[model samples]
Target: MLSDKSRPIIQATLPAVGAHIEEIAKCFYGLLFAAHPELMDGLFNRSHQADATQQQALAGSVAAFATALVNSPDRLPENLLSRIAHKHTSLGIQPEQYQIVHDHLMSAIAEVLGDAVTPDVAAAWDEVYWLMAYTLTHVERGLYGARGVSPQTVWRQWEVEKKIQETDDVVTFVVKRIEDHLVKPSLPGQYISVQVPLPDGTRQSRQYSLSRADQGDSRQFSVKRVHGAAGKPDGEASTLLHTNVSVGDVLTLSVPFGPLVLDDYSGRSMVFISAGIGITPMAGMLSHLATTGSALPIMLLHADHNENAFALRDQIRDDIVALRHASIYVWYEQGADSKLPVQGVFAGKMDLSHVRLPDNAVYHMCGPVPFMHSIRSALIALGIPPRDIQYEMFGPDLWQADYE
Candidate 1:
């Protein structure tokens, strides 16, 4: 909760701060990176940095946090904090880093706002930063505690056992633990961060959802080769993994950490909506359900460019077949595969009109933000409560308000 004194200050200054938040974010990253170049080695995503998405995400988070604090002083944004904490824990973010970020962020605010940053105003914003920072650290500590590992020890080595080509642009890596310690069980829909050394001798990490259910000491994840379009740089970690990595190669992976786990909905129906590579986590959930012999009705509705672009189609099909009350519906923009053993195959973008949605079914979706927005609007119009729908994004959560 924000102090009464600071709440009014934040309310008055939020508009000005929000207006220049992007510039402040840009300045903060510049200052922080110039002072602590080591953070760029593995902690921060250089690609996101170069593209300015990281700055946008940071700016949006701070503005949103501040706005939420003013609007509802009694309650914090647990969903926002939980999402950030999970991502931080997966990246092995330590508590001390928050202090570093605070210092640079404050300096950025001061530099950007100049004379507008009175001491009282500065102190009020400080409260906001620490409040958000502490809340995140508290949540991250619990995440690390639950995993029984500290930030430094959250990563482990896993050797690639096989690399199966899922599509021309996608490949699935099956890896087994190299150490003697027992592998921690991964819940369905959880993701692990894979850190790889780029050709430049710098390491970068990227999160990939567990594409298969827990297999004792082994795990599976898929990566799509990112071909940069429209002047953007290609994905460094993904490109390296696809081209350089092979069987028997060792990779560093963080323990599974994600807030979008599929809960044990014993008697209820589960609806999975996905497009492109978003199917990875859904595949994990389906695999888990199949392995556990779940009786819950499952409906998988997926969208893709074409049959050739659909990764894990066979695996998803097999998992759906294993479940007693599961069915799949696929939509292809170009054409439909009539021979595919699915409940309904349609041509063009995914339309819920052709399929029957189960009564009181919980919806979980992942895809591009626009696609999710379209699906969500459709679902809401069809009388599904927004509270019952959950979604996951591939990169920085720029569409936080939209999802909420």
Candidate 2:
């Protein structure tokens, strides 16, 4: 909770801070990287920095946290905190790093605000920063404890046993520990961070969802080649993995860490919706259901440009066929192949109007922000509770603040 003395000060200056938050974030990163250059090598996503998404996310989070503190001091924003904590834990963010961030961030605040930053105003915002930092540090500690690993010890080396082309753009890597060791088990729908060395000698990291059920000693994850559009540069990590990484290559991987896991589906129906490469986690859950011989009613829906663009389509079909009570639905914007014998596939955008949605079913969706937004709104209109609909995002979560 914010101290009562700081509450009124924050309320008075929030508008000015919010209006200039982006500038502060930009300045913070500049100062931080100048002092700690190693952070860019492996800890931070270079792509996000280049596009300013990381800065925007940071700015928005600080402003939102401050707003919530002033408006409802009695309540904590779990949604915001949970999202951040999960991402931080996945990256192995240590508690001490928060102080480094604080130093640079506070300096940036002072630099941007100039004479407006009185000691009282500075102290109030300082209190706000520590409150958020301490809360996140506590949450991250719990996450590390649950995973039974210390923050700095979460990384392991894995050798790529095989690289299978799932589609023209997507490739799946079957990996196992370099030495004969037991791989840590992961829940269905969890993800692992893969760090690869770039040509420039800096290591870049990206997270990919585990695309299959845990296999005790090996795991599978897919990477889609990211082709830059609209004058942007191609994703460095994806490009390097797609073109240079091959079977027998070693890569650094983090322990599986993600919050979207299917822990229970005993008596309730389930709806799984995904688009493009977002189908990875959904495939993991479906594989688990099949391996466990679950008899719960399940509906699998996916949207893609066409059949040729669908990753792991055959595997998903086989898993669905193995389940006792499961059905599959697909939507294609560019039309499915005419030679394919699949029936009841929709054409053009995804439309749920003609479909009968299962009653009292839990919904899990992963895809582009716009796609999830549209599906979520439609589901809500059809009487599904907001709490019942969960989603997984692949990159920096710029939409979560507004969506919530």
Candidate 3:
């Protein structure tokens, strides 16, 4: 257990450490990759690794560790551990990588902080680091215990059968088989990683929220093209998945994983808020609700550029039409002809004021950063706990920014 004296030091040091986090992340990745190159073959989705999310997440974890030491000074929460373990489990991060990350992280902090790196500061950080590593180490081991190995164990071949365009930028991928049967039971809201062997031999991988409702059907990923940053194109993998990768192209797919999943609505009510392609996971949830005929009160709130581009609006309404308890609030950013299957309708941004969400509503939301942040801030201000909120990234994990 951490003593009272340790709290103030860690709290004070966190902001200082956070300022140089970018540099620390650069050094940490450099050391990690140089010492353990084989990790890329198994543990990294090349495209997502290139994206800053992974680096930011690692750095944020360190900062959060510092916060946890000062504030909680107790056991790591189950939800936090579950999310961390899921990240590593999906990436196939092994037990050894934790030590490598720690050594390099500590080295980078020392190298950057220079004078401020006192004995107490170093010791405090050490305490935080070990606690985090301890949590991840044990959590990963437990996850690996029951996770029966996936068919496409390596980042090699995942055959893409069809690429259907949902929007100008987003496309749905139909992957026939990874190494075995295509139709296996996947939890609703769970996502799979897609690895594409690029033209230059380096592979790029990305996570796509599975758009399909039925887990019993063939796997399909509805991925949006993120026109890559710093001269990088919309990810080699996502570009391939959208443009060239079609009918009979093999790509690598990791097993489905994510903590943002549906509950045994055998008895509870919930609300889902989505913007644009974020509607996919909610579609899956609604489908399950329809199939199971669950009496849970489902309220869906979606904000899109327009109704025409509203991905699953009508399909969702029709799915559970019998359940009058299910209602949709559609907000079209563009003043388009808003008509049909929508209640509490508006033509501007999501109306946060006077918004009466269902009693005991669990808000599952996803969208661009600004949109989700606005909604989250509003909800929290209105007395929503963080646990009652769930969201998924259309691209890489945004849990880092969420933490920050």
- Specify the highest-lDDT model's number: 1
lDDT of 2 by residue, 191-271 (tens): 989988999899988999999987767889999999899999888899899999999999899888887889664588988
| 1: Cα error in model 1, Å | 0.9
lDDT of 3 by residue, 227-282 (tens): 76777766656666677776786767777777788985536678888998888888
Please, what are the lDDT tens digits per residue for candidate 1 over residues 202-316? 8998999999997878999999888899987778788899999999999999999998889866567999999999999999999999999998989999999998899998898
| Cα RMSDs, all models | 1.1, 1.8, 3.5
Please state the error at residue 157 of candidate 2 in Å: 0.9
Superior by lDDT: candidate 2 or candidate 3: 2
The list of candidate 2 runs beyond 4 A from truth reads 179-182, 336-343, 401-403
Where model 3 places Cα greater than 4 Å from the true spot, the runs are: 1-15, 34-53, 75-81, 115-124, 150-162, 178-184, 215-217, 228-232, 320-324, 353-355, 394-404
